[model samples]
Target chain A: MMWLFLVTDALLFAGFLGGYAFCRLASDKPWPDRTQVFDLTFITLMTFALITSSTTMASAVLAARNGRLQAARGFLLVTALIGLGFLGMQAVEWSHFIHAGARMDSNPWGVPGFSSYFFLITGFHGTHVLIGVVVLLLTTLRSLQRSNADELVEVVGLYWHFVDLVWVFVFGCYYLV
Target chain B: MSSQSGVSSYRTYWIGWLVLLILTVGMVFSGAKPVLVGGMLAKASIITLLYMHLMHERRRLVWTILLGIFLTSAVLVVLSVPDGMAM
Candidate 1:
């Protein structure tokens, strides 16, 4: 079930990104230079935070499989915390852009699509991270009480890793290129 | 099959994490080069194979996922080429 959802979701994101590429290629107007607008250092930290969360989530799954419920819970809690930190950084970046007069339709930059795509794509990805954090929290609680929670952790870990994987593309699209 | 028995060790996870971080830093410094795309692909592959345990999964399941990804990429390429030409 999760695999089905993930593959479909991946296709959805690919479509969005492909549309973005088309718009950029077909438009006569110049695209905004993302490097100048975005803070690479800050986004780099956010990427690190999310990637670390992936590692922690993997650790949690491994620990749960090993029947170390306490360690599993601990790792899940850490993963959730790192995810929250990523969200916090995203909020800061968004607020900075908004404060600088960047909007979905209007911005200092002439290209409206830049802000729109940035918000739409990153916002979509951020929502996934937010949901993953909530699910991680619930799974952490479940791990505390359930004797056989390893499979549950593994399932959730897949979702978390998928989210991380999507961010890899997002980072490349929005930030690097 | 208790999924745990064949699971990777903490050392492996840490090493994968290190490699991912290094690739990320390389991307940041490399800017908009074509190699950065390759770097991102490498990062994604490492995460999918090592961290996600796709490498250890059944060959049929792995191939199915790969086929889906390939189809998606092919669609993106096919769509983008016409758009680029129209430009």
Candidate 2:
């Protein structure tokens, strides 16, 4: 049942990834050098931050399952804060790219083929991160008040983890492709 | 079964995360082998396996992940509109 939807979603991303690959292959120009475009240190920290958020988010969910309200709230708060930091790092990364002239219209990769796809994929993932952050914040605050916190924690954990999943893809595609 | 299933999923998620964290560090130096391929495949596989139905224990996590894919596609379309149309 759940696997059904998961398959469909995988197919959808497959199509997108397929399209991106075809475009990269069809072009005469070489693909952008990832090591040059992305600051390794920033990306490394960014990945660490996001990975930590996933842990905090999951711990919060575990706490909720155990009926430990304060622990759950604390973990959720940490998750949200880490998520916020990821968003900030994303913003900073984007700005650095922009300042270096990595526009959606033109670039060292030629005609923004690389830039456009970079934005399309990473931007989409970043939006997910933003939404995940907000949801975690709200869920944590609600847990503090003792509402539908467990359900909310479950929901937000699903989302938090999903975003982490996307970053995994983005790391593969953007940096590797 | 339910408790085992739940704990198993938790354990699975954590293991996957640790692997991801390791791979993330591996990618930092732009490791020559292109870990992206293996890493992405590992990630997609983990979520699909562990979270097959663990969303709210309501339907399954897959549906929610799809909803996420749908929403993300909408966002991509929206972001691409101006450029897509101009092209």
lDDT of 2 by residue, B1-87 (tens): 023226423565577668767777665555655465666666665654454225334454545655766676566555554444454
Give the Å error, residue B46, model 2.
Answer: 3.8
Shift in Å, residue A77, candidate 2 = 0.8
- TM-scores, in order shown? 0.95, 0.75
Best by DockQ, which number? Answer: 1
Fraction of true inter-chain Cα contacts (below 8 Å) kept per model?
0.70, 0.25
Where is the poorest 10-residue window by lDDT in model 1 chain A? A139-148
Give one digit per residue, the lDDT tens place, for model 1 in A61-135: 888877788999999999999999999999999999998889998789877777888888999999999999999
| RMSD (CA, Å), each prediction | 1.6, 6.4
Model 1 segments more than 4 A misplaced: B1-5
Residue A70 in candidate 2 has what lDDT? 91
